[model samples]
Target: MKAELDLARAFALEEDGVTAIEYGLLAGLIAISIIAGATAIGGGLNQFFTGVGNWFSGITVP
Candidate 1:
């Protein structure tokens, strides 16, 4: 009974699991932010390139 109580107390005091979960959540959020930023930048670059291409296509050379 004493050993069981000690084991229960140790389990209750453990923080490693909680710390690992917190780190995992933080990493997931960082990854999501990076993906969102990259997507936005990629869309803007595509539009800019398309506009430049259209503008160049309108020019004629003798």
Candidate 2:
């Protein structure tokens, strides 16, 4: 019975599962942040370039 208790205690302290879960969560958060940042920047930059290209198109009407 004592050996069984020792084995159970060892199992409880095992770090492999906890480490993997932490790494997985970190990776997921990083991916979400990157996507969010790109979307925030992409919309504004797209419009700025579109207007610039139009300005140089020489299609203005007086």
Candidate 3:
């Protein structure tokens, strides 16, 4: 009976599960931010490159 009570008390005081969950949430947020930043940068780069291509196409050499 004493061993069971002690085990129950220890289980109640454990924080490993809570710590793991917090870390997981932090990782997920970081991943989301990185994805969003990359997408925005990619869009800007695509537009810039397209404009450059248009300018080059308009050039004519005699």
- Per TM-score, what order, best first? 1, 3, 2
User: Which of candidates 2 and 3 is the stronger one according to lDDT?
Assistant: 3
Please state the error at residue 26 of candidate 3 in Å: 0.7
Q: Residue 57, candidate 3: how far off, in angstroms?
A: 0.8
lDDT of 1 by residue, 1-62 (tens): 99999999999999999999999999999999999999999999999999999999999998
* Tens digits of lDDT, candidate 3, 1-62: 99999999999999999999999999999999999999999999999999999999999998
**lDDT, candidate 3, at 52:** 100
Q: Which candidate wins on TM-score?
A: 1
Worst lDDT run of 10 residues, candidate 2, spans 53-62
CA lDDT of every candidate: 1.00, 0.96, 1.00
**Candidate 3: regions farther than 4 A off:** none
Per-residue lDDT, model 3, residue 44, is 100
Using alpha carbons, what is the TM-score of model 1? 0.87
TM-score of 3: 0.86
Clash counts for the predictions, in order: 0, 0, 0
RMSD of each: 1.1, 2.9, 1.2
lDDT of 2 by residue, 3-41 (tens): 999999999999999999999999999999999999999
